[model samples]
Target: MAAAAAELLSDEGYRADGRRPDELRKVRARMGVFAQADGSAYLEQGNTKVLAVVYGPHETRGPRSKALPDRALVNCQCSTAAFSSGERRRRPHGDRPASELALHLKQTFEAAILTHLFPRSQIDIYVQILQADGGNYCACVNAATLAVMDAGIAMRDYVCASTAGLAEDTPLADLSSPEEAAGGPRLVLALLPAAGQIALVQLSARLHQERLETALEAAGRACRALHAVLDRVVRERLREVAALLGD
Candidate 1:
């Protein structure tokens, strides 16, 4: 429908970023990035970068009515840098989309966290996107998982997330911004990797019924791969902490 436009997928089936259909972007992450917070982590997936910080299993503040009787209340906030991307020049935080993302973050963690252990308490997760190449939500979830771990919070399992998009019958793993803008079918999935449980699934655009599983499986595989990267980051952080303590 357009002239002089770069294809989302090249003739050889490689994405614009030159990744294979099932290959994820390079993932790099660090845990305990902030000493003041209960837990903090910074993560980068390709060019999408996010920071997450966790504060408190502390007593709930404000209205007693807001406290959950059976589990700790999970509060989440998400913010994106005004200049995170090429065209995003204004503040997007606190808007409708940001609020919805915050809600999703809250829900994603609620399923993974052993919230019952901290009943009547509050756990706050703050996620900030420092860069916005694509897959913002997935990056946020992965960063938050590491942050929660850094805080020593108990969770049912490690939460990992990834996004996939279907292009011309090929399901692309870890959709980049350009791929997402192509307006094809996209799937976002968050998983408790060890439990083989899906914490969240978000689909955008219409995908064939038969292809849904393919897209989901692609996303799941990417999530499992992320689990390995996150696990490595956490372990490396622990070793660093242990070394400092030993010294």
Candidate 2:
């Protein structure tokens, strides 16, 4: 495979993958793929694969030290399988990167969820990276959207996210790991695309203000594209349920 970061090869403006700066990678998602969890989803964007599970709306368990007085407390844990990448990881969770990602995910979901509606409750979201090609944050957000929808959790809007990488003065959409490592500025934006509201924005490196708007816009557009793919998955799931009921 070509390095997504290398350079803009063609003058016509195409990246290593032949996608235009503003074009997103292909996305596919499925809800309720796991039967045990209250809700589960599998999502794939390009070569990255992720699974998200929502296990509660139930009372808080474990130690009471972290319980909250108002609204449900949202707990998030992110883990990547040792074999999720070409290079294996020794430990799964509690690693510095995983812990930071968990916190970010918790914050992002808290923004989308109607937590006020479920006072004194709890929601646990666990995300596992089945394959870590790149843009893990965006993939997690998209997968979590499906899982939350499967759990019937009330939300203001779908939380969609996508990665943007700056290339030759243009912001390219949906970066893979190679592009990310190429040293260009990259931004991960999680948004309630339907409402045009940003839930989270994280930058991998510094980018100039003059180009920030275009990059943000590109990220938002990629997120909207993600939302459409997720919507289709949800609809297909409902149709499957309807068919089962008929049988």
Candidate 3:
């Protein structure tokens, strides 16, 4: 029994996806994916793909009672496409998991955005998982952060998110679906890389107190790595705009 338990994740220290422990999958992204929205971005992390669109810093909708006096209200709606994962998710909307994830996204951005500047207004963020390889929450947050920045929203810092899973003593970064299914406890983090503040942290299950630090360190390292890629995407987007204006 002890030998089997020790070998649960002992595949020569490599993940099923051929990723070494603490390694992240390829990160690719594009900003301004849609001309209609105030801001939009498409991001792909390995096999997982997500799209994010942002509208406003404009007047609050519906009721005036919903507007905040001191800061802008962040409204977030997150969903998974029925076609994602080569399967159907009938009635993905309004489900408990979807609603909870959307709430988490709302909270994450609210903490990062400088809402006081747009008092009485609202920023609407819509993010959809077009493909779900794993780590859907982190991908949504990463894509939305780009959308918000492309919209020229004021934020204290870039919000980068990543997930970590501990397999025995090994910490795997940027979990893929296979890794997630491996049944190890997982940790997700939304962090402000520049400000050194954590916007959100979630653990799928309890982990050993001693292992928690390593898992956190692995996730935090992945977030910073993602931040670098996101930053480059933003800069390239700016250069493209500048070129268009010059032409």
lDDT on C-alpha atoms for all candidate structures: 0.90, 0.86, 0.90
Say which prediction, candidate 2 or candidate 3, comes out ahead on TM-score.
3
Model 1, global lDDT: 0.90
How many times do residue backbones clash in model 2? 0
TM-score of structure candidate 2 = 0.94
| All candidates in order of TM-score, best leading | 1, 3, 2
TM-score versus the correct structure, for each prediction: 0.95, 0.94, 0.95
Considering lDDT, which of the candidate structures 2 and 3 is the better prediction for this target? 3
In the range 36-82, model 3's lDDT, one tens digit per residue, is: 99999999999999999999999999999999999999999988888
Error of 1 at 231 (Å): 0.6
Q: Quote the lDDT for 109 in model 2.
A: 95
Q: Which stretches of candidate 2 lie over 4 Å from their true place?
A: 1-6
Better of 1 and 2 by TM-score: 1
